[model samples]
Target: MAKLSPKNLHCELVVTVDEKINPHIMRDRNTGQIYADDDYLYRLKLRSEKRVIECDGLRYLDHSLTVDEEGNQELVLRGSCPSGERTEVEVVHRFSIPVRGRYIEERITIVNCGKDRYYLEDMRFGFRRGLCPAYEPGQLADDISRFRLVAVPYRKVGISQDKGSPSPGARPSVKRQEYTMEDMIEGKFSNVDWRNDETVVGQDLVDRYRLRSEGWAWTDGRCGLLIVKYNDEMIEYSLVERNGYSRRECLVFGGAGFALYREPRPASVLEPQTKVSFGPTRYIFFDGGWKKAFYLFRDFMAEKGHGLPDGYNPPVNWNVLYDIGWYHSDREKLFKHYNLEALHREARKARDLGCELLYLDPGWEVCEGTTLWDEERLGRVEDLVRTLKEEFGLELGYRTIGRVYRDEFPNEWYIQRSKEKGQYIRPIGSDGKPIGFWEPCTECREWWEEKLRRILGITGEGVKFMMFDEFDWRGPCFNPSHGHPVPSTPEGHVRAVYRLIEEVRRRCPEVLV
Candidate 1:
């Protein structure tokens, strides 16, 4: 038994052992609020020799406080793997509560001690702590109703819910989806992962309330528990699923576990003799509602260099899409309202309306996703930028997408999904046209280099803003010649996107992406 009593923090974290070391509770000293209860630390699953082994029900070994490289005190808890498995694995849970900080940072380091190559199936780095005691089935307590699970899913980040609205605030991506603890207790959730367009068989059969979110907060207006994980990969966590109507009401981090939506198994592997760390997940105990959690998330992100630059004052953009309308790759309709002359009229309107930038949506390019400026239709890119600035008094900006309106690129450069089966490329659109509208695999070196070159060319012409939109993961790209892993993982897709953005910034640091 041990208590982590950080002097600067308002709460004390208590760890206890009952076969395993459980980070049992975190209690707020000032308000006398019990923020956490019934907390177990971690769970891991591995596959070897066609046999599945679970590293849960861990046996407690010892714990100690040590100074990290940055001089922060970290509480390290050591544990032994269960005696049942033939293979040996060592797991350690490290937690740090920085001085004068409101959050506890946690991570689990797993070291495979055996010789066999182990495939990591599932790893719950942090355990869910119950907010309230167990209640009878179908019964909801008033206190429980006060507690809401607030989550900000990754997809909603940086995107405005309403496209036509004014410039979004700093926390535009912060979605305050408040589902009361009572909601989960009462079993309120969709049968499928419809939110992400994924459906699975017998998913609803288990009454687990699963939600996809980068981080979440369990709050009751006055006090809250915030959990956030910041990783390079475009991955999220599910901390809201409570299994099968049981009264264990804690939100488990690996409750539903990590896997591609609708995939039968995990795509992660742990080679022998390698050490893997699962998190640096922040566990914050704060005062006030779920918004406080969001503020902390923002602050943490800023610390990670994800925030705006010191002097970033983005111009108020007047998007011409509202007036010009999406031409949908129809040359006839596009020329009618989306030509350079029409855009000049819109720029005049933007200048008169006090807008600082005239944002082109979809028609400036020869075709959507080509990233080629239609010099014949819109004149030269540099000339247009000078005109937009000198004549209209507005900076130039445009949107770019990964999906092509037509198949200009080689068929091999496009996305190839296994689900497409024998079909080599995407079929024609429902309109019986070869809009061959599939996203080019960004991981393809040739496509990546070409896209980078095109974007750099546009930015070089004094384009101030470039919005890289619709570059989401369509699925694993199965093209063998692409040089990426066969059935490329979501992480690979995300890294490729990041690489593109980073390279763009490296070349054109002044342009806002």
Candidate 2:
């Protein structure tokens, strides 16, 4: 067949695998690892086989018209099997146009001479944007473009509900569990595998995102009837699910093609065969515009297909934070020269730019005889919070440093109680060890709870958020009387601090707990 280019195309081919051969035995030529046994084995195998073409009829083209192997015009298939029961399959694929745009098509086929039946599982076909990087160590950082799987079969397992339990005559009711693939395919599946690297990994990083695994399963099954409309352009892949009583389906897409083979347990069974047809379909292509593509995909699916499944809520959008202010005094230097008025102005600017919360760092209270709000230097906390909400439409939050308030106020009660309980007091230097100062009464959970309630009541009045900080630190205390048994490990201390946070959340759910 003549090599296909972006300019001229339309082709088809047929591939068949017998029933007795194990499809899982096929190893990837590039990695030398079995490609058919991985999580999405069949799909990977179809991607690797690059020989078949899809068109109106099969016709061999001039060899000179084809692209050189190194020029990206070659369709090639390389395979390996360790058990030596089946013939290795090879198919060479070549593309004419160097760049893929609006309209495109691909074709592929497999020849099986093995003695076993091969079950056809899935097929993937599409014109991938950007260069596909060779599967080598540490190559992800250099690859700019990615191979995205445009379509695939959906595999899913469903659970059934149970009937009345513990009833003697209730017929031992049971429900059925089922598994199946959806016939439809759409969306972009990337070829950047993150399972290989850890440091520059793609999975957890927020900015680099991909279609989730669960989303792929929902659109499996609607074979030939599916159409991928890119903007106004549409590309069609043909599908043939049941070729005959003895053969399975052949799924073809884009300018690329795919064939499936089911592996057999023993080497003696006859291979199964099937023929499938797709296309006469159209592709609506857009130029260098991804936003348009996304909108078109969503609209086409909504109008002609099903939308996202039930219970599906898009991931929450969160403000990406660099470094939160008000946590460390060092960061306060960013606005140190600014007084209350200047700080309020800067905060208002941040709010206008979509900042959801304003964080206040520690040093809010004057550590004196009456640990009162430091009105002289920091201005009125309540007034600032009110201005943030009414004037700037922003939320307020503060850092909580678990230290004794040395001034006169409701906090003074906590100081007095700490003394009465003999929890701990500042000790004069003896050795070089850290000294224990004011400590909460660990034995009296009520004391902690009451103190927290009082503190929350005062702070939560005007604040919309609270950043509890400095709760994890070492302190000397083996006082059995006050109930704290001196944390034995760092993990224990961490857990204790987390427990306090949980308590705060349980008490105030509306406060962004």
Candidate 3:
């Protein structure tokens, strides 16, 4: 006898059966009469019955063995309902793609049985990466992170147009009509794709791989197709809603959802229609080796009959800082008054309380200065960095709001740009209208690049990290210096900031770059 290896297991099945039925009855037990209509009949006796056949006694007609030729076992299960209207369900499952040197897969299926029309409201499939849960909420604070589910769709309702608009030859020309999902899909929706992945940490080293496609579904009277993938020991599900290959828009429906967890006991009896819910599903991808998982899962899904959108890039892990203090005044104040010395002393008291970085909030600079170092209060910036590094074994970081002090650096390019754009320094009034005495310039790329370069040079001596403050406050650039008056959308603005960070990384690659 040979020991069963974890990698070579698979399950597949196909079920066919009779229709299911459900019965609804109204009875008068005391009168010994079943009433079809109690008010209308003097004395009525009626009996009605209906039959329902749900998923029952459907065993795997195929092999349930754990090992197969494809490095994993495949399971295909099929069944049918015997109600007046017959319906069939086909379930295909692939199990045991290796992750952290283990193989696993779990699949489930539900078929419509009741007389009432059934809707495929939502579908969810989930699995554990290793012996442990995939990820916790706290792990998401860093740049490179792993998540359980990568992408899910948000449901959007379509708006219809009115039919009373004037014709082109009428007195006034009508406005161009707003497009529909069909129109957009035909015109713009093309070359889309779905990619997903997961990573598992091991005792000695991390192991990862691309998840292969596990199963897929095509339902009657439904406008879209749903596909599921069990890859890299994680689940990847994609719903592509389109009209043939002609045109389609990927609509992501936003609402509460759930992921099925492993039941404590498979044989435990349960009631039907149990309510379940899950947390907010964010579309995020893994970093490093985990990206391969996404590619693999995407390929598997395409193979399972889901159409890949043209040129769709699966979300990848990118460095993003959601500066909480930028929007919240209280958070800003808390960070400002944070006791660094006390924190350092307390950290030394505990064996596990040490941080490599000490983030300083805004207001470190003298409210009246233009230089990087606030000479009056913070003293020399270099001295502070040295003290933090030497005493607490931590690197110091500071925030910059990109404001220039006219009295100090009187020849700043931003001031000139502001004047050219006809922008005035509005005084911070009680009404929050005219806010304070600093020149505001359109965020020209050249201006920001030059500013970052100067700041980097000044802080290059000792400072290790830099936090760009008030990033959200800097609105879209509309001046001639910006090279274009077109407003920068949120996505464009985020990309620009990322580019700036990349430049900073390039400049300071070794100093914890």
Q: How accurate is candidate 2 locally (lDDT)?
A: 0.34
Off by over 4 Å in 3: 1-352, 368-371, 401-421, 425-432, 435-446, 473-475, 485-492, 511-513
lDDT tens per residue, model 3, 212-325? 112222111111122233322122222222111112112221111121221111111112332122221111111223234445446544655667568743321111122322
Point out the higher-scoring one by TM-score: 1 or 3: 1
How high a TM-score does candidate 1 get? 0.81
Candidate 2 residues 1-513, lDDT tens each? 222222312222122122211111112122222111211112323212332222222122122234545433323222322222333332223322223322222323343443334433333333221111233212322221121223222222222223224546544423221111111111112212222112111123221212211111111122111224221111222221211111212112233222111111111122433222222222333322333444544554576556665775332111212222332223244335334755576576667677766665544544411124556666777787787778877767655655443322232222222223443334334454433334343223554556476556546556656566544333333433434433222233344556666776666654543
Best by TM-score: 1
Superposed on all Cα atoms, the candidates' RMSDs to the truth, in angstroms, are 5.5, 23.4, 24.4
Q: Which portions of model 1 show Cα errors greater than 4 Å?
A: 1-9, 17-19, 39-41, 67-72, 84-86, 128-135, 138-146, 152-176, 189-208, 243-267, 419-423, 427-436
TM-score of each: 0.81, 0.30, 0.34
Q: Judged by lDDT relative to the true structure, which candidate is superior, 2 or 3?
A: 2
Between 1 and 2, whose lDDT is larger?
1
- How much does candidate 3 score in TM-score? 0.34
How many pairs in model 1 have backbone atoms within 3 A of each other, for residues 3 or more apart or on separate chains, i.e. clashes? 0
- Residue 339, model 3: Cα distance from true site in angstroms: 9.6
Clashing residue pair totals per candidate (backbone < 3 A): 0, 79, 57
Q: Candidate 2: lDDT of 416?
A: 24
